[model samples]
Target: MTGEVRRAETDVEREDAFAVRFEVFVEEQGVPEDLEVDGKDDEAVHFVGYAADESSDGSGSDADPRPVAAARLREVGDATGKVERVAVLEERRGDGWGRAIMEELEATAADRGLSTLTMHAQTPVEGFYRSLGYETTSDVFEEAGIPHVEMEKSLD
Candidate 1:
């Protein structure tokens, strides 16, 4: 997975990032449309992964522009960043795209002076986040009909 992950701050880029999440979570995972399309999008920092054309297997040209992964980072307070809506295309899973996105998100949060990062990870993926230095902070709860747990990590 030697692809580039781009951080998006502009409106168009954010929308494109959200679109990818919608496709994976809402459309494919059966998450309700409204629950997936939250109002926090506008205020969140988005990150996107584009399959590098240079790394294509020759099945398609590198000129094809497709977002294979995305994540959102929102400021929860003066020193906290909330990571949300992290999703990767089904076929792109297990290739490190998700971790890459989170790394970028943490860098962004640190750059913004945030010392702590938090997220509500779906139960099935909690271990994934935990492996990245996050620790569970709360009991599992239901979100959009899915089991999730709150996790946090300090970047200080």
Candidate 2:
């Protein structure tokens, strides 16, 4: 994928992140609104991925990019950060956008002096996290009605 990811530093950028999460989790995955938009976003660091909207260029010129994926990192204590709200627009999956978001978050975490990173990865995507150096730390459990497993990776 040739897209780019940036840390969300403004309200508008954060809203873009939330919009993608709403589409992927709430609308497509059947996750309830309350669970999808838990109120902890204010304390987290958000990242958004943008892909070029090629189809928007009817005149054959380059089109503006659109936010296609998003995730957040929240410090949960003990110098460990929890990765949360990971989502990529269905049409943009397999384009490496998800990995890009995680990569950015991991770098940010390390820069912030985090000793580790953790996430409750959905069961189906466990392998994805595994490939990124995260190890399953807990047995499968239910979160927001979806099967998940706790995974962690040490930064040190």
User: Which of the numbered candidates is closest to the native, going by highest lDDT?
Assistant: 2
RMSD of each: 2.3, 1.9
Give the Å shift of residue 136 in candidate 1: 0.4
TM of each candidate vs. truth? 0.91, 0.93
Global CA lDDT computed for model 2: 0.90
> 62-121, model 1: which lDDT tens digit per residue?
665567789989998979999999999888899889999999989999999999999999
Runs in model 1 lying further than 4 Å from the true structure: 10-12, 53-59
Per candidate, the number of residue pairs that clash is 1, 0
Residue 91's lDDT within candidate 1 is 84
lDDT of 2 by residue, 20-102 (tens): 99999999999999988788998999999877543233343336567889999999998999999999989889999989999
**Residue pairs with backbone overlap in model 2:** none
